[model samples]
Target: MTATYAEHSARKRRPLFRRRSAIPGFAVTMGVTITILSLIVLIPLTAVALKAAQQSSSEFLNAAFNERALMAYRLSFGAAFIAATINGVFGLLTAWALVRYEFPLKSLVNGLIDLPFALPTAVAGIALATLYAPNGWIGALVAPAKVAYTPLGVVVALTFIGLPFVVRTLEPVMRDLAADVEEAAASLGASRFDVIARVILPALGPAWLTGFALAFARAVGEYGSVIFIAGNMPYKSEIAPLLIIIELEQYDYAGAATIAVVMLVVSFAMLFVINAVQAWARRLSA
Candidate 1:
């Protein structure tokens, strides 16, 4: 009877809202995360928006859509998109080779994949310019066609920096894929191309899209590496970030803010679309 009374008392003591979690301090952790994000990301973005808002609508439009600014936007977004696309294809191939094959100096090759990440952007720009300049070794091979100090150079620099994003994002996904799945598909009379297209690619679609988005985002804001190679020619190879710096230098804070707001909006829109595609891919794979 005492034991039965103790059980009843214990049940009564339990709170209605009490629920256990695998990780403790959920409320505290969430609060900390929100605070950090606000400090690091949201607040700065808000400040930019506020600064842009200070401008009259016509002034903002004039600053953002001026002929030179439009050209810069074209160069920036166009080069970034092209570079990311190239990386998407070649990066997948590179990741596949690293995961599935054995080759000479395999460890060294794997390590070298991360070189871009560690190399400073300015250093990378200088190195690329040296190698691709008309007088340089590789540049001599393509002497007739200008590479360095052209928009092509901007694309090359962006591609170099963005490659690692796609490769790194896809590597773990490829590593975890089961060889048996491919073999089984073969046994069912699937051709090699078909197997890759139908089985492997579908499974990797979400991750591939994620990598592409990351590469695009990184390339969009790239400045340090591109300036050395791009020649900074207005309405030609000039990129948006350089234009922003030029505005800042000229003490056109409102103009700079307007350009920044445009970039932010476009980048956010592209990311949103990519995320939607990733979600669709996930659903299809599942």
Candidate 2:
């Protein structure tokens, strides 16, 4: 009997020792991940760099930094920055309202927040252009403001698409925040403004930065939606991506590559700085 019991116990222990994880081994998984990343991301970026390098340094500089390119860059980066700032402020308010308050049609409103994501960029552009045309409904209401076919319209289009990034990034963080903390602050004689400024903002600072960075990045690369509204006027409302397409259309691949390289470098640098700041904020909040 003792031998029988011992054999059964050993069978159970053997299965425990023999069981394997469902995932592949780390080496295999890591190798596959690196191979995929190289194929999809690294190789294309390298090709772009090499293509741009085909041009002489002066040629590259002229292509990337000429009057037309500079104007386009200014508009693209400036509009993206402004749009991201707007999204950051209003996205916070929207997320806060969703998480902290009860309202009629709450579910419908929450669902609508993701409308931009499901909507195609071209469709969104056309819809926005029609709605904001000087003769259109909302445009007629704000007559003489000149929304569509201007730099302002570019900002508006960017803000429309980028808002979802900020709001979604903030929603999870806002939900994680405990109401007890606010109650505790209130019970201790802190006013509503004081509670928000001192208690809520600190906890959300990192997430806010992350959301702002995401929105800015999305807006920087936007093309289809912005082109429809911006009117693509050179030195006026043209954006950097539009310049890239124009270069391609003119059969100036090297010039297009140079412009792309410049945008890529600037965008990467900005995102790196934003991420660093986000990390610092996280450390401080911790």
Clashes of each: 0, 0
CA lDDT of each prediction against the hidden true structure: 0.95, 0.94
lDDT of 2 at 245: 95
Best by lDDT: 1
User: Which sections of candidate 2 miss by over 4 Å?
Assistant: 1-19
What are the per-model C-alpha RMSD values against the true structure? 3.5, 4.2
126-217: candidate 2 lDDT, tens digit per residue? 99999999998888999989999999999999999999888899989989999999999999999999998999999999999999999999
Regions of candidate 1 where Cα sits further than 4 Å from its true position? 1-24
Model 1 TM-score (2 dp)? 0.93
Lowest summed-lDDT stretch of 10 residues in model 2?
Answer: 11-20
Estimate, for each residue in 138-200, the C-alpha lDDT of model 1 and write its tens digit: 889998999999999999999999999999999999999989999999999999999999999
